[model samples]
Target: MSDRYELFLTCPKGLEGLLAEEATGLGLEETREHTSAIRGFAELETAYRLCLWSRLANRVLLVLKRFPMSNADDLYQGVLEVDWAEHLEPTGSLAVEFSGNGSGIDNTHFGALKVKDAIVDKLRTATGDRPSIDKMNPDLRIHLRLDRGEAILSLDLSGHSLHQRGYRLQQGAAPLKENLAAAILIRAGWPRIAAAGGALADPMCGVGTFLVEAAMIAADIAPNLKRERWGFSAWLGHVPALWKKLHAEALARAEAGLAKPPLWIRGYEADPRLIQPGRNNIERAGLSNWIKVYQGEVATFEPRPDQNQTGLVVCNPPYGERLGDEASLLYLYQNLGERLRQACMNWEAAVFTGAPDLGKRMGIRSHKQYAFWNGALPCKLLLIKVQPEQFVTGERRTPEQREREREQAALGQSEPEVDNKKVESNQAPAQIEQARLSEGGQMFANRLQKNLKLLGKWARREGVNCYRVYDADMPEYALAIDLYHDWVHVQEYAPPRSIDPEKAQARLFDALAAIPQALNVDKAKVIIKRRERQSGTKQYERQATQGRFTEVSEGGVKLLVNLTDYLDTGLFLDHRPLRLRIQREAAGKRFLNLYCYTATATVHAAKGGARSTTSVDLSKTYLDWARRNLSLNGFSDKNRLEQGDVMTWLAADREEYDLIFIDPPTFSNSKRMEGVFDVQRDHVELLDLAMARLAAGGVLYFSNNFRKFQLDEGLAARYVVEEISATTLDPDFARNSKIHRAWRLTAR
Candidate 1:
């Protein structure tokens, strides 16, 4: 067994320091932070100890070779020159992993393929046999990272992404990435809090990542102890006896550290869906006895009896990515701030949010703010220091006390009084008119106002902006839209639960049929078109039959709508304000519409005086409809349509546009595309490609419906993101304000 080996410990961004500290604690030298990775030299026993103890790491890789490669041929030569048989047997299966930026080789799949070919070819020529390629459950997983022109290949010691700690039994719509969650906990200073006997609590703990991570740190449990296998176990150089000895030592260390009664760690969430996964994750971490998971709202939670000791309250609250409105979110934050100040006096609080403006509404000044990437979305973990000594020992008043003082100060102040007799004389007839408006159709308007108020109250208290509003008899075709300040959230509310899907469909169709009635347009001025949902085994087997309607004027103006369709008419009504913005801003400029489903905005761009428009979409059917939309808008000759892949096309195209609208599906996988397209994971690449074709001073309007969509922080340096969700919301959605987050990106 070697006393020294080059080790590359990998962690999610912002966690390299904690992992480095952990490595140092294990007697390994501190090394530099690479892109989502850390490099160090440690003994074989130290490597094993790291695998056992590191909480924030994703995987540990043992460096085998580092060589310069100017191009693909150089990459092949360098990989082939390495001694493959010494570590991996010819009969064993192998997998290649690729990462890093600014490489001559840009394509990860291509780079991985080249590396695999080089390894196999070298083994075949030398020993007349080669390892089989197994992407899933490979015996030996190799990592090839090309930074600039330098190629560094390593043997993956961890079999999977360190995030796969074997605890998650189920997941919600958008669960936190495990490694990222661990990084968040570490960033919030969990180790120090744990050592000081401060309790750790997650108010909105989905799947209990924070709770589990806190418990693991408190108990000194090795994060990877539950993992059944590692890539190194299959390596030829791996010594079973040495590995056994290291494992035994780790077990003894864990046992020795278990002397104290478990630290107080708990997680709470309102949704029942999160309970099973939360419990499963805690149990999987072997901290079930130490941590407890419960289903409840954050507003009503009471701190435990040990209030003398400082505690940490870390929460990842919903940013209205899926539901609710801005007004509600503001109120929610206000109430949340009040509750935290009132209920958790001695506890320090850290709230992680991708949206910063909403954090401002919490009214608590953050002591420290750390930036992190939540799968490409730039998120901030705001830490608020809440020391009881400040409240008890200071002459300064609490925020509540200040409010009381202000109210007392206002007691002596008075506004100018008007003559009530003269005011009544002037307003008597107006009051009767007001009574008439309130009694007639104004009754319905009053109901709408009252409903909005009730919905607003519920949305605020629930800490959500997106929700379903149950009401009937207003504009049945109208779906109220709201955009929360944080999370670029979009929420749509239809009539109450009494109106079933079929009834809603009928009402929607009637609304489409009556666009002329609602908007006071002629039937001849309206042209309706339908969009078929994409089909596959999943969609076809599910029998998901749905289509949208596009109404066009006889004079060539298009009005695409989903009046008769199920939930949302394909057209987002909240963006009515933004469509007007396009008309105002787009002038003599080339426009690009990505993920352009119905191309309504494309029409608006053309009408707004754009010189030309190029629309790219994977759906050929939608592209055809987009063309019709152009024709209806009398700008058929002013637009170009492409019917293939966006990612591939963007990579190959050299054309630049002055304005680009990128609104992709929340989640989708097309047959033509290589893999599923996740807005969070693929945003950086998509934005990079889009920006590559953007002219100087060009603006890109990027939007997504992933409700919990987070923008990647690393990409922020390249483009500026401004939240336009608030300006896009329509009046009907005032109750739950987050309709969609729209950003105007300008290249630096």
Candidate 2:
């Protein structure tokens, strides 16, 4: 085997950058990050160093060979050519891991079997002793990656994922992987903080992963020092003498680190069940004296007085699932924010959470947010500078004192002190900023407050938590605002040529500012979108991909909507009236929904006791959202959602429906479709196709959002069409009657 070879260091998604940095720091050459793994070149010694020291890597794979092949037989032949005796004894045990989907051989099981057969047959022919397959830990672990007929064969230097640091003797429910917790710490700047003699804390440390990783970094202890076994132990390629020297050096460093006073590491778990397990893990890692874990709730968490006044407070807070009620979790988050503000002023913080809304409930502003994935769940690691001045202290004052502050504000008096420093002098930067907002921004803020007051009560009376609170109420703003629970969504209409673009932007910032104050929510929860003419597949283009979705209720039905992604927020508020009408009219009827963006209407119909519902849309993204909506509301087994062009699906579908809803886009020539579609130009043909799916005397709700659309008069004469535009307008969209036009049509 060559001394220098490509090392494939795999990590979790969104952690490749951190892993690459770790590999480079460990003396690897030419390190680069791809998708969820890092690639680099390292000698045998450096590769062993990574196995001992890397805190963010999942596995260290040393490539043996790379070749081209076209089929499974070719793979077998390629494997047989490699001298297996060089890496492992023919009498030893082996295990194989095969990944990658494409190529003629897509089955990983079959691929592994073929590779295994080749290895055994080659060894049996040469040495008369073939290795036995070990399903668990093996003397040699082989990894094969196949992509587009190209293969990379590598030896797994680490028997299992490096995240299993062997320190975790017991675990609680859903414990975080050790390497991921390490990534969160490194990204939060814990290494630098610890080096500077600062402390670290995890208020919600479940299994002591974060505490153990933090202690390792601060003490310069190798991450894998506690491992009892390694993949290279019994392999022929492993230079036992060289490995022994490296292990000795690592042991000396760890011994020297232990003699020094380690950075203060403390963790608190609210549940007694987790505290013992966390302590057991810390003890097993030989960190019982350095890192301590205790039972305590976040509501009462506090750092030891002997430690520094501030340090890095990092945590992996429970991100309650989207479908469950998380009322108590919100309070827990609030308490965490309070604890950080009151006790850890000047400290840095990193909160890893899947639910951002719950994070916002903390009422703290973050300096920066990094995206991460906890398995398939997209999460955010919010880096915040915990300054005490940003929180609300609720200082009480007499009415007279309040009047004085208000009058002083009116009279342009100097402001109160911040952190005991004068913050209102004209020379101060904060004062300069407070005076810099444009007039248009102030007007937009005032308008948002006005609209919120006007609609808040009406919304409460009508059980409308999600509605359009503002829709270009003043032309200068020219924006539509929506409220989905506690979140604010703003959509800016394309401005006319006569308007100045800079002024429009200032007004948008003004709106963003006013929303949090008026709605009593955090400004970080706001999502903004620009409305413009879309052609071809422009509407289907993703604006953002956080995989963030929230549940919103409408007329007693819960539907999932992604406010920060796509051109639309899944559910169209303008179609509220139409959806309600369909719900009332859909009892005991079979329903069909075409161009169903997220099947919100179909959900409504199914909730209203429709016999069965089928929704058709071309975008798989929307279809997945529709299915999630169905599952969220206990209707997963009751409805069917198909991903295909509405026209093609309609032609192939022969089942008759008692009710049908068609709401196509104004104009579309989507790449997924067979031909161009224009509601104005193709309305006749589209309606004819949809009409064929309706049962005798069945009703069809035909609609579209083309403002200037004119119905084909010939079809109207053939069918009984009643214009429902007047009744379909909700109170919030009353002034914009052209938001969407609809008509109930039945065959004559």
Candidate 3:
């Protein structure tokens, strides 16, 4: 009979029961449970089978010996008793992973050195040779764990932690360990649902850790079957024939599992770049046929099979601490709950988050909450059974919804888009004048429709998707409304309180209510911003955490516009004409963009066949957005997005560009800049600095939005300056000609 050896199985903390059950199922005998660890005694063959079939086991350790020691010398003496020649050859390479501190042995490195000295001395005396120490990628790995006054030395049968399945090639910011992901699935009751022939969906899937883990569970596939090597594979005591036999059994079971009917599983991720990585992982797992990953957002995610069918929706959305402030992410949790409560009747929902308070923001009453650990953070898994009766929303009911729709129509508020239909302003002129609306509301709606009519033709002809539709056109409704493709952005110019506050608010509400209907847009697609003179960077401060974006074209270049998360969308719609001018003159020229928010103008230059383009901005957030814009346009590495103070960069730059665009802020005392910048006070210095970098026969387009700005007469005469501010304004912005000023300067 083969001698039995004590085996220790270790896994992530909080998963002790699941690992213990797995060991028992694999025929392990005398299994004893501990927190985050399990101990059992079994024969070598049983151990081999456990290595091949146990999915939750992180490492299968064979306990070599246990001894009580008082200090380093006693540790060395006790370790020397083990036969050194029995395990590794004198010339073989070995590494020791020591953990914890013993009595009088406080440092792990010193303890490892002492153990090595003892083994080398015993082997050298007998064979005149000693094993070489290899700290990294060693042939044999030894482990020693020290308690109060005792130590247990063991062989780590699993070379590396089993969390690495050798399948995940791409990892996003914060990824869950594979074993921990599997444990979450088990804790969420996915196995029971899958056994009953239900499907699964993950809306906020990041690189698909949860989806891949869920697929493995639903398909009944072993997790580590793809692993090629284990520590025991090279050990002197390994039984090769027995391991190979169990490996073949695992393969047979996997093959049988693959033959079962397809499991209905789907994963949705908002970022398009991450979908490919998820596909690669699924393919590597041999479960591509069962899982489908889509590039989408949870806000618009409508899982398939809307009627009668029931399934589970599980996702690991970000907690407030890791990504940003907790308040910023509260809307995300609330939106997730609203999605589930509104659509997922009879379906079960599980939300796993590190911040328990964020879980409360989910809005649904969780029937059960399971405490788990994601790495070291205390997390909660909220389980909710979605039902129609559980929704506590502010949406109007059926009759009230219709009444509201009719009232909105009477007030000229936009309705949901009809199938292949739009509510254009050119529909009828006389009918709008005849509609019943509040006097101020009717006039506000009429002005909006008129501007859309005037700009629509020019916008279509110029291939512009974003333009200023109304720039403070009506005094009563002093607001600038811009149309970015299908979404509307409304910026209200704060009026003086001398104007009746109630009257101004009423007029503002009338305009807001009219925008969606008059422009054929959804109310949710409108982003409202209050424009006021700022003494600081509050103009660029973030407003919301939705981070929602849409694609809009300007001057034949596609750009991404974020409607939420900031006071200003990435693109400046009034600069549409200026961007087009740059594209017209950018061929074969080098381009520079200073104060380049999102670099939309730089993208136009690059698309216009500029030899090279450099975009400078002070914000890393905007720089990252600029990089994404360049990548979206398929620009090569020749384009660079630089983050720095524009003045400093201009002073340090020795390279010359054929064309440059400088659109500085009116006033910015940015902490990143060495000094404050005011366009009126520093225009000449900024202009001269830019002209110094202009190549021969080059012209610099200097522009700013400062309303009351005057040219520096001396500097203007120094260079041949041509004021082309008239041509820079399209018909839409003609009403507000003083909105911006542009000048073309060239060396005489």
Candidate 4:
């Protein structure tokens, strides 16, 4: 038998048991479990095997020796006393890692420096030449842990963080760590997943982490199959023949256990930016033939017939904290719930959320909720069982019925009723109509209201469910447009026939001339801002060029649009169908919106009898316009507005919203934030954050206008990202259908 030694395997928090199980499977004897670590005793060959097959461990360390150290000199002496020649070569490069809390050697770097010096000094004294320090990709890694007065030293057998499972060649923003992904699959019961023959999907899959993990589990492939080397390979006592034999034997065992394709695995998202990296990761994992990735939205995604089984859908959606606001996130969650109930009936769903209130909006009670951590923030992963029978009716139950059921259930319990009066007494009055305008501002508001009425009538007369409403009234220079649904079919207009600069100018004036008198806007108030589109500068330009337009509105909340500004200055015509969708479904639901550009959807939701509304965005200017829109429609300020980063906000909030709308900019660069945000690059983190805060039975309507967007395949397991692009296009945009893709996502 090979020499036996004690080992401590470290894993991400909550995965200690999994690592212990893996170690035991590899013939190691588990001795104990710590908070985030597992200790075991095994022969040197078993240690090599553990590094090769374990899925959830971050690293495997071989304990060298333990000693007591009260000062920095003691630390040096303890490190120098170890048999350095047993692990390090005189010509090799090494790195030392130190971790400890509440110790005299508190600074990890300083401790590491001391350890490195001692190792080199001991080696030089024994063999003249000492090993060098290599911080980046070291050949041999040493670990030092000092807890209280005790110090322990070990050699890192896993060269890199095991989370870097060799499957991913590329990554998108905040991709799920591989070890964490594997743990989630395990927690959700992967054995059951394989038996069900249902697809594994993540509708907001980013970087293919989930897809690869699923494939690995399905194929019985060891998670580290592709890893080229481990830190143990460079040790002085390394046995290449033994390790090779162990690796080859494990690979053969895994190959023998491989079965036919388990289920159809897929993912979808609206942003194209994630597709390449996702594909790269999938290909690197050797799963290019098993999993497929598509670009679409969750709002209208249809599951394949084969996927009709009660499979799992897991998603990590944006929480609106790093993305936008609670109200917008609510809108997104509501839409997600609606779509899941409509299309993916047989699927079991799991959503990882940091916000408990948002999880309530999924409408379905969770069969299991597991608490985990994404970085330092605490989060919950809710597993919801969605029976196929629940999809027979398209409509969600009324809010009154839902509330009544909760009350009855709460009262039916035999437990004594606790006094809840204090909770109610401390609650502020529901601020549903707090932002409504007074009668004094009725003149211009009335005109805008009349215009909305006319627009709705015209939409109905023409059977147009969606169209743009441009009010040129002065006070606000920005444009105010609404995407109406229900009455008018939203249509995507073809790229306007390319017109000569002069002709475009004439057309702008003509469209402006059509404003109705009841709306009461003078032509003189319209000024056209014009310029030329520079080469690289054109993409970044926000102002209109070669257009007949002028600043018309101030704070009065006027809808002044310049058609000459690129192609879409007047309105986002795609959401007309979605807004109508909200109006048809919004009765008696609370709404949340994030990155609410102008709150047009809020107006529609309120009109549809929404109980309350909250809008969040980074721009105070847009929030002001949203407030104006609510007031114009006779809706009270009961709707709240907040200006902050959505990610940070959701991390701390606990409120639940029934309807959510998430419409963020295609790309934005804020000096105060980390860096510029590209919707395609950041959708996974964004969707994860959003789903965390949705209320049960809620709907989330998420969209982005990156014309060439493609979806990430890993997200399919969490969200059923459906393509609602066909329904979102306006009639005017028939010539060019690539407007925007909208999706709805829900837990499981």
Candidate 5:
């Protein structure tokens, strides 16, 4: 055999540079980096040492031969010329793994079969016996990578991937592979910290992968020392003496490292079931004396090492996949930041996560960030120094107080000291993060105050308590602030992709800070929501289960609004003018409300002395809500709320109505409906059905919120159609004229 061998080390994506550095440190020569892999040259002893000590490599491949090939025949001939007897016994089992597709062999399985056939035929001719295939524990494992019409055949020296360190038998839902965990540790500077006798802790440790890898690093233990089986264990070229010497050296180093004082390494998991499994893994790695795992939550996690010793706090929190999950995980990240600030002073923190947006919500600034790939998903590792200066904290001072501080500074007087006791107590981190506002935030606050002063007079004069005060007044702060009695409902428009997420988030925080102070409302009464395009029933889904309703008045009618339950607060404030028009014109006439969400307009028609009222909707939940509204107004006798598909209901109803109001959703795909509802496509049929039920000389009021809606040209020819969209706009909705479109249709 040769004294020097060409070696290739494979790893997870995005770790090629780090692995190259590690391989060079481990005595590899002429290192070259590729995508997810590294190529180098090493002596037989160094190859054995790499197999024993490499923590970032997934596999260590020993290149045997490189040849040019263009077809399957060339592939077969290359393997046949390798002289199989020198590498494997005739009766020994082997497995072939092929990667890359080129030179007309596009299928990996077919390429592997072709290689196996060539090897078997060559060994049979040479030794009169063919080798059988044993895929699981093969005596020899050959890897063939075809790239750019070149075939590179190699032997896998490290079996079953170097990541399988033979310690972890049980893992959690989403466990990081051992090699990736080691990469994260190295990037977090764990090696230098461990050498300095520092400590390590993972607050959200799942199955203790970080703990085990860290302890092994601090104790100078070879990761694969306890492994029994390897791809080169039964190879014909195996050097027993060289491997033995290297293994002995590693054993001596471990023994000597263990004799020194143990470092402080610990992990805390919230799941009780994982505690035993984590401990078992640590014990199997033979680091039980150095590492310990306990069942604990992140909120109360306190790492008490030596008093003055500082270390690293590393964790991988869950990245939620659903929209609703982000709401709850937001608090989890905030709590983690709070605990770090309170307990881990002066320590370095490394938070690895797939959701960088949630990571920003932690209220701590990270000095450095590194990008990594966990399988196919992109992730980030945020490095922070847990110092007092890194904490985002300040008291929320008013404009007067800020001006006073500036004046005091000008007069050679010291600014008043903020009470640190409140911040250090059990107060929420978000509450303590009320720092000085930016110039844009101050301008936003001024606009809000100006809007309140102007709209307040209009609202009280019109007997309106729930009106929109501000709607995207400035482009930078994209939000709609509506007042419902003393509460403020703020809906932030989702920013476009061109906007930076961190800047948008900061602007949102500034807007939220300015809201309560500008409107003179309690912070608890401010309901914030993110507005984006909705499909199916997402717009109707309840955001909270507060189950509390508030009574409000408009045009001599009582209504109930549930601000916390849904995206829309029961009442459609933009349609106030249309509802009032229906009430005024419904005297002594039968009224029909189609697609009645909560029957708010139907209640107005009933209160306007309509002989009888009927409302149709698909949601039983909203039907129940409509029933409560009628009961709250004491007009349940002549009012009828039917829960069914509007299109299906309109087909079956033969009763004529003197007045009709139809407001349909832009799109709906509820399971209870036979087919999806698209207002743009089905409006003509809907309007035709409702017109057939309308009494002669009566009016049909049609409206929708679809901005792209085009009225059917055939309908105007069939009836006298006049667009009343401009007349439906109240002063509160004048800013957004396209909020809804209305039309008054009369039979000719």
Candidate 6:
């Protein structure tokens, strides 16, 4: 009824700025931007055109009214004030969608019901009839958004979501929505490339989303050209003449564009299952002549266009969510980089990935980066120009210099700064092998290989999946490398203050460069941490928030290890022999573990058929981790986890145990404790409290990593104490005998 109406354009996060610019170009006036949404005013004709052409919007809504509300009654009254008769027929069907929560309408379902009731009541009184609810194909679709304390009611102009462009009914796992793909293409400057008659290719296209969107952009075809139904199609105030005029104009433009010479757009997918679905999507989009999808692997993907025309090479590579899945995907990203380097030279490349670190492994530097959100996961789009200068060779080269070198080679002249290199024309620049590793790196790699050769057999013969492969074996490279299943965890011992920081850094780089190549592990599987002397509870604090836990097997028990979150992984590798000893001797015995970090030993005891077990720790985080460890072994109900100061818990306990373990921290000043605990100053009193709970004939195993820890001589007078540190050493830890000091004690 009005000459202009308020419009709300909603899109995915991080695309608000782009949407605002696009809206302005679409003739939207008085524009305002918000998070994930843009608001503006537009005439009816402009609204129709926007719905037809907006490739970045998820939904286009026309606002009816904005009101203030403090409660559900206010919300109902606000809805009742609007004249529903003008928007919906009495016999028609409607759907009410409500978002946000405030003013006592905390539940979205209840909010929608209240709005629906207000509409129904008004319509029933006005015409003695009411509309029925139809969620899928509603004649009038209402949207109510509660922001702060205000209610904004609008009508949905675009039914369903704009991302569902009607062509991708069948798709592969984790397909990108059409609208998001279009946004990525625009960011990668695909339109500019297409204008120059360049070709387009997607090596890892899932379901041809990028291909379809790219073709549409290049051909100037409206994204929603084939949609038969719209939210406004059945509205009471529908303007059929204006809509028909716009629709006809769009159809003519699309037909004219299609008549032009088609662009060379292609997609290659490795999954055979996705090949037909991708082809079907292209066919449904009516761009089969402009786009073709072939079953191909990333390692062998080579797009040959007419006359060596190079366009944009875009892909949405799979970046897995799990810890184990990430390792294998490193090779996928590497292979993709290799293909781009070897096959698609002088092309513009755009890679959208949730894992930015893996994107860095592509061996090319992105000229520009754009951040976007794929649902809740943060993602990045890397724009790279596939030229020789962009390749990250050992020594970084400038574009001007590389171009000069190319010119010199063409003239059959000697080049500057030669490194006696053997270049494989087909290999990626990173794989050139000339600068693969430095002299120090090569020696370190040789040592790692030697260690693995010796340790691999011992690990298999002993059925060990977790073991220390290297521990400061070379004085120059002081890093402890341990293998947890297929993952590598490296800890760098802090260099002394007298050492030059730059030289130390160079050596560290050499060691890191050598690790993956020598061990045959992907670079993504390696987790590095700096090891320094920790004070108080510093060692227990989290170093990262990834919360990614990996599973490893040790002595027939499954254990969980957090490779990223904490300074130390949950399981202590040096304690392998002690845990196995507990498992071997825990049958029919009541076991107690004090100062239990993650309750790893308790899990071992439970697996060994302990009658009952009790574990005490001060940190709730570690106790929770311990519960998971116990539950993972199907021993949750039989085990007891006590969270408090071990000293306090032991003083309050009256139960006795047939076996006990005490592996206290070297120093802990947790706020949960009555006072600070120093292993040297408090060992006597701590052992006395633990011994009181030991039953007759019960055995106690005490161990600590405090290098200067000396067993109190008076304890030998009170009980029988035998130093068992040598016996607890496993083959992997045999080289480091002073790793921990252990003693077995029993009643005198």
Candidate 6 lDDT, 637-671, residue by residue in tens: 77999999988899999999999999999999976
lDDT (Cα atoms) of all candidates against the true structure:
0.67, 0.81, 0.78, 0.66, 0.87, 0.87
Clashing pairs in 3: 414-517
Candidate 3, position 549, lDDT: 76
- Model 3 segments more than 4 A misplaced: 28-35, 125-128, 300-308, 320-328, 393-748
Candidate 1 lDDT at 368 equals 84
The pairs that clash in candidate 2 are none
Question: Which residue window of length 10 is worst by lDDT in model 1?
Answer: 413-422
Order of quality (lDDT): 6, 5, 2, 3, 1, 4
Q: Model 1 Cα displacement at 100 (Å)? A: 5.4
What is the Å distance of residue 21 in model 6 from its true position? 2.3
lDDT tens digits, residues 539-643, model 1? Answer: 212112446454532112455543333234445645556666777778999989888876778888888899998988887766766777777667878689887
Give the RMSD in angstroms, all C-alphas superposed, for model 3: 12.0
What's the C-alpha lDDT at position 690 in model 2? 92
lDDT tens digits, residue span 1-748, model 2: 6779899999999999888888898899999888889899989999999999999899999998898988888899999999987888778899999998666787999999988998888778454778999979899899999867798999999888899888886998888898999999999999899888888888998988999999988888898987867888888888888888988899999999888877788998888888888888898889998898888888677775853456889998887553112334554676687677546766888999987655665646788899999999999999988753343323334566546545654444534333333445445322222222335545666777777887888889989889998898888777788999988887878788888866554455555544555566654576777778777668777876678989999999999888766778888998998999899999999999999988999999998899999999998978988888888889977598988888888888899999999999887777688988878988888899999889998999998888889988898788999989988987888868889889999988
Write candidate 4's Cα lDDT for 1-748 as tens digits: 2389889898877777776776788888955777678998998888888888778888999889889888899999999998788777778899999999445677889999999999988888544787888887777899998877898898899999888887777777677788888888878776578666667777778777887888788777888877887888778878999988988987886676454654678877667898888888888777777788888766655566643355678777775552113333443454465556545655677788777666665545677888887767778888876642222122245556446534633443211111211112223211111111122223434544565686668666666643555423332212233333311111111123453544333233222222222233332222333222223223234443445432222112233333444433433556667777777777888888887766777777888888888878666655765776676667875677777766566666778888888877777755445556677888888888887778877778888767777667677788766667788765544434665788877767
User: Candidate 4: where are CA atoms >4 Å away?
Assistant: 101-103, 125-127, 257-259, 388-748
RMSD of each: 20.8, 12.0, 12.0, 23.2, 7.3, 9.2
TM-scores, all models, native as reference: 0.54, 0.56, 0.58, 0.56, 0.72, 0.65
Better of 2 and 3 by TM-score: 3
Model 3, span 1-748: residue lDDT tens: 2389999998888788888888998878899887778999998888877776666778888888889999888889888888767777777777887878958998999988888887777677454667888776566778887878998888888888878888898977788888888887887899998888888889988888888888887777778888887887667787788888878887888788778997788998888888898899888888889889998877777766646557899998876442123223544665587577545766898888886655654545788888888878988888888753333322224655556545654444433122223325444422221232346756778888888897898888877778889877778788888888788877878888799866775576557646766787755567777777876567787877777778877766778888767778999877878898899899999999999989988999998889999999999989998988888889857898888988888899899999999998888888788888888998888888889999999979988888889988998677999988999988878998888999999998
> Candidate 6: what lDDT?
0.87
**Local error of candidate 6 at residue 171 (angstroms):** 2.8
Model 4: number of clashes?
123
